[model samples]
Target: MIYNKRLILAHFWLAFALFGVAILLGEWQMFIRSPLHGWLRNADLYYRSVTAHGTVMGYVFPTLVAMGFGYFISEAALGQPLVGRRWAWAGYYMIIVGSVAAVVPVAMGLDSVLYTFYPPMIGNAFYYIGVVLVVVGSWVWVALMGINLYVWKRAHPGAPVPLAMFANVAGAYLWGWTAVGAALELLFQILPVALGFATTINAGLSRVLFSWTLHAIVYFWLMPAYIAFYTIVPRAIGGRLYSDSMARISFALFLVFAMPIGIHHLFADPEVGAGFKVVHSIFTAMVAVPTLLTVFTICASVEIAARLRGGKGLFGWVKALPWANPQMLALALSFVMLGFGGAGGLINMSYQLDSTIHNTQWVTGHFHLIFGGAIVIMYFALAYDLWPHLTGRALLNLRLVHWQLWLWFIGMIVLTFPWHYAGLLGMPRRMAFYDYTAPGMFAEGVSVVMSTIGGAMLVVSAALFLTVLIRNHSAARVDPEPFTFSRAVHEPVSLPWALNGLGLWLGLMIALTITNYGYPIVQLIMTPEGRVPPVFVGGKP
Candidate 1:
């Protein structure tokens, strides 16, 4: 039986529940922004919903899921019960309480500063405190993962750490440091102002500090999905991993490159220097290397699966692979989205091309495609794979799973493609509503309406996804096979210290971050002119 079943189930359930709510709110955002009728057609209510939706999805949902999944990995990969079981439970409750603390203020319309650190627009102090609690809870998980790995290594002496656990640890460390920038901004900066201990806030410094976090945090969210691609998909499709070492290198690269490169997000802001922006843009492109490596490795892994199924010649193996299987289908659909998302990302990361779509709907479309489309689809696949093991009840409806993934894929495309087009047409993002009746707005209006239909499909898909899981809860119990991950074709019996652990990579990440961010942040801090008096969103800042 899978270890710590109740805790695992709790994590997945909360994650999906929050996901469902966020999905509904997202649809509403799309509706209000479109020409369609919305129940609450108020701008304040729209921004409130946006704030809540972004906060839940960006912080609470992914962190909880990753923590839960990490706990599962500790047992499934390391063959030990969680080292800090009580701490695990404590962290769980911390997140629950934190989620409520953070979101309640948003619900009451006291905090509408949409998710990211939109400084100069401080909200209720509780909102900032709530998010910190959630991050601290995840840090507990990070500590536990590190402890488990250390304990296992001591006992085993020289064995290569399991690939799943190693990558999990990398992600845990990635998050540990990644949260620091935002944490600093909150505890030392935002909260003080939020509580009226300070009159002005360093809005520019806040953005720079948050830049240390925003991009890397997405990778932390992507870790579980990437881990599944490396460790789960091939096995589910009946093949071994392509290269164990390549997988390690890719993950290690992710650890090194992902954290220090988010300044590219601030390219348009005059407060950031051109040289720093260019350097960050270059490193931002470097982040793509790991994904490229992942695509190659996973494709090779899938090809082996197809070839083993007796497929001949060049592309015939694709036909031989199992499309009906949920994991395989999800992987296929995920790559399709990734291909499109990655193309847009190239434009986003470019020094020159970025200006054309800097604050436009293109940014919105690009992120949603990457996070909501490519990443979240894998989350669904990963959950589906684990459900039978977690609940000891099989998913009885494969057809529903297929349709749900297909709907998400279609909806994401229909939704994002138009936004990309409208961005090119010079439409701005992050606004509650636009003047659809104005000249030259026909295309943008039409695009919003189209994407709203797409958002509706996504809403239905989220509902159907929850239905599939909830149905499994009530299904009859069975002797589900014990959990295991895919093996590499050439699994290493022994490995170097760096590949087997996160220490070297963690040090490298910190050094690189210091190099990239140290001067700019110091400059921002030293320059008193960058400080802007706090502008309260729903109240006095």
Candidate 2:
């Protein structure tokens, strides 16, 4: 039994560590602001901590969990062992090394740039090395994913791709393409300059290139969420996918539009041209089509399940649906949270509207709601659902799990909703301390009091979550096998050959990119002599 146990335990441990660090950082940044208030805050330390948090949560946990899921899917769908077990282990160690190396400098207060360390401002050289280690480690996973996809396609020939493998491959390809921009910035621009191999680097160019990666990374982070939406949510609701082909089409759409729209991040940056920003802004809005499709499809699948189970009326199905079920609850809340957050995103992506809200706490409010509130809630739900079975034990406390989710959702609303108001009222993000000493200068007292209250709520909610996780680990009479879930209905899907293909989607991505960015990017690289140097605007002006 021990020999055959999945590596899910290891994945849980890593996710817990990373999540713990993130919550603690949230606490520190929210409550104790002075440590970072001064400009003298160590760059090396700041960068290290930021990198550690980002890599562990953003890179490590997701990759490990995806690998765990991949292992299961590969066995079930393909009926074989992973092609290279040793390489997988090596990749794991590489991730560990990278995570450790990356965080040490930050905790020590030696690295201080935020997670995205653009050129000219350098962190400890070790920080760059650590990031590279992580990138390379994940690259191996991509290679493995590619090989797996290749083998499956070769074996099956014209047979339809399994929904599970197809989803995974879509994410894998999206990741590969997204990483290209960040990797180039890291390897060719940031690292060389940081290491002193180059005397000067174009900060504008660095940001422009990094812009190519920034937003798509969110998709990488959300892939696991999407995977669960497709693979687990339907089954939990006693239904199969609404349409297998639609799922593929949504993923294909995500891959096609996700990377190119990163320039929406540069909408306010001066270096990137307005035309490019406008083009990306359009794509940014367009990308929502695929996300909305997923939402509609998943919701319809749940509705079908409820109807089949004797639910009645358009809304009666909601009552029949298992709101107490973890995955259902997670998906439900995720849908609600995305609506609020997506509205905020729409404002940010607006070419003209962004100028009014740029760099304000509204941006923070939006991301925290989406990433921290929505995505993290789902992670907890998924882990809770998987851990007990993986550990061969009854859940330590199901009640606590439900309670924690409720508190987290409540806490997130209490914490972030006000930030939206404060941002519209002109609150800034990343400020270590507020300069609200003068009465009537701002809603100084009210804002601070409300934020503090929000902070406390968040802390309490996080404490509940930690308790739930710990209880699961220490539960008595742990079951050795998970409660297996099965779909109530299965649907067969076949697509027209065009819909079955990825070639069309790939072409769309290329065509859109060339039409939108061709001139700006080309001029940036080739006509450097004609360009005026960017003005530095941040001093005592």
Candidate 1, residue 134: the lDDT equals 95
Off by over 4 Å in 1: 38-41
Error of 1 at 191 (Å): 0.6
* TM-score (C-alpha) between model 1 and the true structure: 0.98
lDDT of 2 at 179: 73
lDDT per residue, candidate 1, 1-541, as tens digits?
3569898888889999999999899998998888776445568899889989999889989998898899999989999887888899999999999999999999989898889859888899998999999999889999999999999999999999999999999999999999999999998789999999999999999999998999999899899999999999999999989999999999999999998898988999888989999999999999999999999999999999999998788988899898889999999999999999999999988989999999999989988998899999999999999989898897899899999999999999999999899999999988887888789998999999989999999999999999999999899998877788999999999999888888888889999999999999999999998888988877674
User: Which candidate wins on TM-score?
Assistant: 1
Each candidate's TM vs. the true structure?
A: 0.98, 0.88
CA lDDT for candidate 2: 0.69
Residue-by-residue lDDT tens digits, candidate 2, 371-445: 877777777776776666566656766677677778778778877887777788777766655656545535633
Regions more than 4 Å wrong, model 2 = 1-6, 34-56, 61-63, 438-441, 473-490, 493-518, 527-541
